[model samples]
Target chain A: MSAIAAGVTGNNPALNIGIFAVFVAITLVVVFRASRNTKTAADYYAAGRAFTGPQNGIAISGDYLSAASFLGIAGAIALNGYDGFLYSIGFLVAWLVALLLVAELLRNTGKYTMGDVLAFRMRQRPVRAAAATSTLVVSFFYLLAQMAGAGGLVALLLGITNKTGQAVVIAAVGLIMIVYVLVGGMKGTTWVQIIKAALLITGALAMTIWVLAKFGFNLSSLLGGAVDAGGKTGEALLSPGKQYGATGTSKLDFLSLGLALVLGTAGLPHILMRFYTVPTAKEARRSVVWAIWLIGIFYLFTLVLGYGAGAIVGPEAIRAAPGKANSAAPLLAQALGGPVLLGLIAAVAFATILAVVAGLTITASASFAHDIYANIIKKDKLADKNAEVRVARITAVVIGIVAIVGGIVANGQNVAFLVALAFAVAASANLPTILYSLFWKRFNTSGALWSTYGGLVASIVLIVFSPAVSGKPATASTPSMIQGVDFHWFPLENPGIVSIPLAFFLGWLGTVLSKERRADKYAEMEVRALTGAGAEKATPH
Target chain B: MSTSHDPGTRPDPDEPDWAEVHGSAEFVELRRRLRRFVFPMTAVFLVWYLVYVLLADYAHGFMATKLVGDINVGLVLGLLQFVSTFVITSLYVRYADRKLDPLATSIRERVEGGAAK
Candidate 1:
């Protein structure tokens, strides 16, 4: 599945790297200015809850649509045809699940992280510990996936073949993300995301327009071009069996992947974190409305970009190198308007990666400093707002270092697969607990703790044993066998089919079997979650 | 700002009385109306999406059935996913405003008024 791209003109990709550098500088300047306003934990964690529905909406879209969607899915569609479009549909629909069932309710019930909601009706310490544990688990997998994929992606696209050079590039990315979280916090990060989201949309739109305009704005001709370029395999490209659905396990694999995508978006810690940036439930709901439309339009553009790249760039050229699929958009830009357009896209991609990494870092740090260290460890230190803020910043530095190391270790993995693993964990572990906390009348401390922990453990164990981690070719696309070991058991690539149900069942079982009941507080939490009665108010920084 | 000052904090007494709000008919009505939208909609969307996934996986001929020129059933079906999402969003917003919002407002007003005393 790794396309060893042929004919890389190898003429100094420094132009692309140079563009990435400019983006980093602009982000730093904004972060520096924003730092002055982030003296409190509220500013550090939730952006002082000042973002309007539209602004937060844009930021949410930025956070949700990472390199995986922008680059990975485009590459998939370019290579696999119809199945690639399936990924986009799954991602877009997941937002609706979030907008309808989770968003406003989450905003009304919780104040900071998803952990806030999990601990809302349960015993504070254990429930929070479980929540923080799951949050870190979800974020780390997601962060590692983003960091690792972006590292390889930058190095390859810039044509930086040196290992040391790649390491340096990744290190710089890690350091800058730390700065964004440390200096700008949530407020600074939001602005960076807004700018990046706009750039990404413009870049994708330009490519789609350029491609479609080539074929007289006719989508069928675009499909025809793809077929013509592909020769005999071209017609097969229009269908699904070429990428998936060929093997007997394909149906199960598709089902697992579907469940993860639809259920996972609602559970993602970073995406859920965005709901808290707005003050009211109404604003929270409105922001989701903006996100779905914005995100929907973006996915449609990817469909055009993906097929256009296949038709124009050709599959042979893309497969000439492993991971040339990731370079589809950039290569398309180069094809359309030469180096200038390519540079613009490459820079936007760099900014997109930075914004997402910064968002993940802040959320992870908040889980550590606010939920675990500040809340659970030093329960009495709650009044020391300055100290909590300080610890959160320090935690950001630590998380940044860990992400860099993990990225290096996970280098060369497929960006999209890594993202799927993260989603599976979120959907399986974090989601059931959040739903039960807000909705179920009998949910107790034991049930919350059991479900959270059970889901996390089940996801990790199943993934490790799944064919995805133990297949073959060892590339991001191939079924990977871990270090040539292949101790495989699970058949499905995604763990959602098994783990999601297991997590929910464990929560229910724990509740039914437990001696202690929480009925007294359940109605109160339900009221707060539903009506925003006595919900936490946003403060000015 | 509820737990900003103290980590692992309990509900602040300065806030509204939760038991009163929980018992209110408006709060009950809000939960019911919201569920009416969420529960059914979630089930329907999941089925609609899984049908797409299953057809793509099992019935490739159907998905690839060319309809009107070069366009296929698969392409139209895939695009419909986006359309359905927007329709659901618009519907939810209208429903929330018409049914959920008023009940929520009444509950909030009653709680705030009682807390003010």
Candidate 2:
């Protein structure tokens, strides 16, 4: 990295630059070829639902395992030890929510977006309107987060802090992501995710094996070595609350964050969208099982990477920069595999961000074009396949531009928090609406609308006033209100504990109060959701 | 191709409407069998996972209690979380294969106006 940073890479940069170019080049080629196959709206939106369970399963994991999991978790472990592992564990367990409740039923029910499922039984216009708002809110925030993180990651790799260089990096990434969805559609996106997932798993495994072998294949000793590496703060390193605790608000914060982590994936538009790419409910069921195995296998390595970084890289070296902890795994890569392997990891992380953002863009486009524009605004426009595809492609460009601009503007913001906020909002707003629609008989259009809008608004309003948004430092001499405005009253960083239940309550209350008792709606949904008897079929190729 | 098939809104004529399917013995049995596994599994996992989280948060020393050299109670519970997810998933898949799949097939056949089970 220093060699690259100093413009003195000579040989190492070639390997790094070569790998990056080849990966991007291959992706571009794949999209170009896929563009030919993307003839219909179903083809564009869901790859004609052609994916096998294992294929889509691998793609789902690829859609997951963001730079946060690859980079941030390792850093947390390096800096905070056992506490860092909690974030990864929470993420892993969250899949239970997806696997058991969301994935297969979602595959059976929806065509394009979450709104498709929610609006399946409810009054279409109002329910779709609410779903569209939440979808955009989650996707845009998540896109901005990934894009901003892209700029920083690129800047770190190039070892240049120049604003122009960072902006250029962000633009390049944004453009590539836009091209991916617009040209190749879901086929292009899924292939990218598969390749990226393979690379990620391979990279993580190689690094982990190297770490374990270095410790003579003894696991506990590696952990012990980590414990002793701390000169005075060794005990703190082994404890549970280093990251979430010590602030006197640890328990509430931990639970709220946990709630968001567990329930958030069920609501994410992109992850939910993966279901529509598979062919059958059986495959959907099998896909989650495959995803479970792959993700579980990966998390084992993540644990090794974390502890290995803590032992090899040391906390002091990791904490050298304000948010430099994310560099822990990369630094460990350099230590273990030299600049060559480090380059590989960097390219893979770039791929991770790219694939994730591509998924986000496609899902957002689908929602805007299908739900808001086609269904709501242009409802009476006689069905035109060409028009819907065109609208979606146009929406993709607009969303891409917005995300790029947001990414560039929010460059200095803490992207990690942005992602957490997205999760919190997803859990609070989208999850309740989905659950009620799928499960509850009394669940009316009013309940769905109230939960979606109420959860979205409630989460955002609470976050705006929360200390995490703009933290207030005590003492006037310390810093002014700019550090954080003093009016911030919300206690927890995550709104899941508060907003999630409130959304559920709002849904229930609205249902009970409303005169619309849609037992027929529930009856119909139950049959379809359970048996896939009358559900949308994969387009016959 | 772009426009979604509005299938669920108006049930097709050949297949019995959802109300009939809902009342069918096969459908009732299917629901019961699914609930037998899912309800218990969901409750147990949620309760157990929450306990681990609460203990970690509220009971620090208990979590940090070292059962083996350099290993602790917290570590054991963490490892179990992974173990339990696999156990539940494997169990569900097996149960579904043995129990739910055949029942769903029967329910579908009946809903399509097949011979009564």
Candidate 3:
């Protein structure tokens, strides 16, 4: 039957490739046109700080609502009800921190990256270097997840080979992203994000309403049916018992997942950089209000989609793609309707990957071009507007290539794990420095550097040693290398709890050890920054 | 940073004295209140996050500690994470309106006035 259907379709894999190419071409054209007026470093990194409140706000949410949120969370909920909702709740609540604490403050103080904030009251070299390194690391890890997700979706949706297809998809997405950032700069990136976010939320919400209507709006009945299908542990659907439920474990997985989602949101570098595009702190705060509303509704729809997938498609399909569980949403769309809906969902999924990767790539590029190369290594010598833009485009290509390599290396991994690792790094490296810089008077360059380094080192070390990083023989599956090591020792699949606090401590200590310079040059710079007086004195190249 | 002649805004290059250019005491006080509010709010949210994790881990013991049919203290606490987020955010905004907003406005006015002169 499968062969017959395949023969009837005359399944040309090139059609799928062509379909992807058309979108990439359209995106590049849009971005290239947008870049025509991009003139300065600020324009390249922050779109000349010209984004209106609503536009930037939507873009912020767009950059944030990745394939992980669209597919991973929904699939999780479909497979494990309340627990999955826990991820959504944790993710949404972290925005309160963003709205109230981080967004306005980041806008009021910094120019481009988290490094700008930390480097504000410190020397240029360490601050810029540290910031660029952190941005690259976070962006690279994030790109890995997006690439993994694209590969999985292509294989499932387009029937492209999982191995080679993954690489091709990763390269295509990376290319689209590079073109976007290189041409449109921040402006192009922001617009792409806004458009993709709108499509994703609308698509998810539409699919969700359709699912609920099918189930007769009976939440309990739907869940109960899923639970039955889940079998002995009742872990198949709507609850945690079927497979992911704690067998003898003490619910540590639950705690870790919760921490990663909640704390991780506040720490993301790409998301943090979005605030810089807006003109004012007030706009920054207002935009988040819109984001919160949009994100809440979007997540609510995910719950329906998850439950719908479980009740309709059953648990067996989900099990068949455990490592690629995030594919459940698109798969459910395919199963419920015809190929058109499936293609639309697939297109939406591809766009989601492209938009997110663009944000990450641009952020990483800005850190390299603006912060490290021009500002630190060159000591702000290439302050000419045109020169900076040229440098930015070159850096964008370089960062894209590096990310392509990283994604290829980390191929076949779980998308959720890659996302978690990115969050872990962000929470450790970026969050501590940002919070301390804005609030703490004693915070100095030394402190910021130590915090950045400490967080980066700790998270990297822990992740490297964790079972997720273990290179056990594929058939063994039992983590055969564990002579004295096991996943249980760490509890969570990702380690934010230990790393975040350690970073904070290092930052605080760095400040204390450094000599106090009251009303110093750095503090004066801070005064100018907060008041917008800094921009008046010298043009941001 | 550009030399704009728009009155009652933009800092004047001639004004070297920051104290004279600074906003009124009301503005300074608002800034202080804002800082104060942020500190406690951050602490409270941190605690709330930790409590969610703790309860989720040990909730099996208390899942049966019910208030109604199947809805127990554990379940309530689990959901309360969402509640506390809204509560804290609302409180932060209210505090800002009462304390921070006026001062911010005052500072803006002073800064603009200084620039015009």
Candidate 4:
């Protein structure tokens, strides 16, 4: 195992860095070109709503499929087999909630941010403030996870094992991401995502076909190979209970994770913001359909890639590697097509991180500039029309710096929970308020505030007290993030099951307790959301 | 067609009467049509997903039962989720095209046309 680990780490770092540098150079040129059209607040924030459905769909997939989906899920399945595929199912299924409940409606009602829709029928300042707060919190947590993952990935792929070296890599990634957002804004960022998505899907498809060919294009043979390579625990790989089925509490935890993954996508600030990049509600719907196909197809590839890694790379060697489960796909690439293939895949992984972080940074900065600064602070009375875009650029730089610092601090910790926390927060904090504001005529400012703040607070509190934070005894293979601490009181790892219902209840309670009802506002919002009447039109450049 | 359209009776010259539109039979029917499809469909998919999760949790033996060579109940069920998602997406798109878009377009045209007048 040690020898195999050493062999995997002996990958050509120079080749990997060379590939990554070329990708960065190309994307920067694209960003510079895309920035030419970004003039207004609309252009900076939403690419002037010029993207066709298919183009936006590919970009959405790029934004949606983070390093976690590509590397994390593939690694997970490679290690855990059937249990790992569960994450893919949860992720793919979550898009349906986005498509059915939110996509077209949000595209019609919102201008730049989720705050736009929430404040449409409510008191603008307070509601916009609440929406911005949640959006920032969600985006920050997600950014931290991606940034931290970047550090670990470079260590594994480029063999940059030194702490300062990994930190430098993380900072460089952050700097590049900042450049992407500051220059291209939404238009540039969307192009980056589109390029990344195309590369990621194509690369994964190539590897998937390669893996299938190894076993005569038979899935059963692939599964059998995985089972065979798994040794003593071989048969367990083909079934559930390997990862989440240890005890009753673990089983319940799986359910909580399921709830979060399925309900969370619709509320994700970054994902929700992507809808504004398209021309119309119909285009938004079309983009979602495209995202579903792209994302769904990518996940199917992960299923094969995971089992293939298990079969070819073997679990023992994968476990011994630096990133453990996260090392699966890269190691599989090495085994199948040697260092060049590994380098290309590593570049794709880097592109995944850069694209996703750019998306989050833009969403967070847009929320702050559009919601907090323009609406809350300046009272939507900016002296200059371009001030919002200027503020957004500055906010992007600040967010990039914060993410860099946070990533360095969280570099070696168990950061998986952070991404899950983001999902939980979105589902609990944002989703309920969005549903109520869009559908319930009686939903008032009080309900939106209560649900957004309440859900945000509840999920964070639950996470702080959950076993994921503490109380779980570290195994020989994995260490807890905070060792020597057992302060956890909440039994579950995911806060979605408890927090989601609590948010819905609080939203209803908050509305009933307040006597504020705006029938006319609700009517206007309903008409606009459903029929696209009086919605923001795509500006002709 | 409506008294609100008469300049003498209107309160705001530019803003359409949204409450009136909301109360119109077409808007009500449109909302109903949307709710009728999405609400039940949402319920169905969520229930289907929860059942799959619950089964995976408690019914380990059942899920592990081999359906074919190296293929088990769990893998098939998981793949079915992908299938179900694709099916639901296609069905919703078709339904929206057939029942929702035409109605929404007419409502939008009438409201915007009224506002212009």
Give me the candidate number with maximum DockQ.
1
Error of 3 at A524 (Å): 4.4
Candidate with the larger DockQ of 2 and 3: 2
Q: State the RMSD for candidate 3.
A: 4.6
Candidate 4 colliding pairs: none
lDDT of 1 by residue, A478-527 (tens): 74736567778888778888999999999999888877776657766777
Judged by DockQ cut-offs, the docking class of candidate 2 is acceptable
Output the better candidate (1/4) by lDDT.
4
Models sorted by TM-score, best on top: 4, 1, 2, 3
* True-structure RMSD, every candidate: 2.5, 3.2, 4.6, 3.1
DockQ of each: 0.64, 0.43, 0.26, 0.48
Query: What TM-score results for chain B when candidate 3 is compared with the true chain B?
Result: 0.71
Which 10-residue span in candidate 2 chain A carries the lowest summed lDDT? A1-10
Off by over 4 Å in 4: A1-4, A476-478, B1-12
Model 2 interface RMSD over true interface Cα atoms: 2.6
Candidate 4 predicts chain B with a TM-score of 0.88
Return whichever of 3 and 4 wins on TM-score.
4
Clash totals, every prediction: 18, 0, 5, 0
Model 2, span A276-382: residue lDDT tens: 88887888888788888888788878888888887887776666532377777877887788888878987898899999999999999999888988788887363
Arrange candidates by lDDT, descending: 4, 1, 2, 3
Ten residues in sequence with the least summed lDDT for candidate 4 chain A: A472-481
DockQ-best of 2 and 4? 4
- TM-score of predicted model 1? 0.96
C-alpha lDDT (0 to 100) for residue A140 of candidate 2 = 89
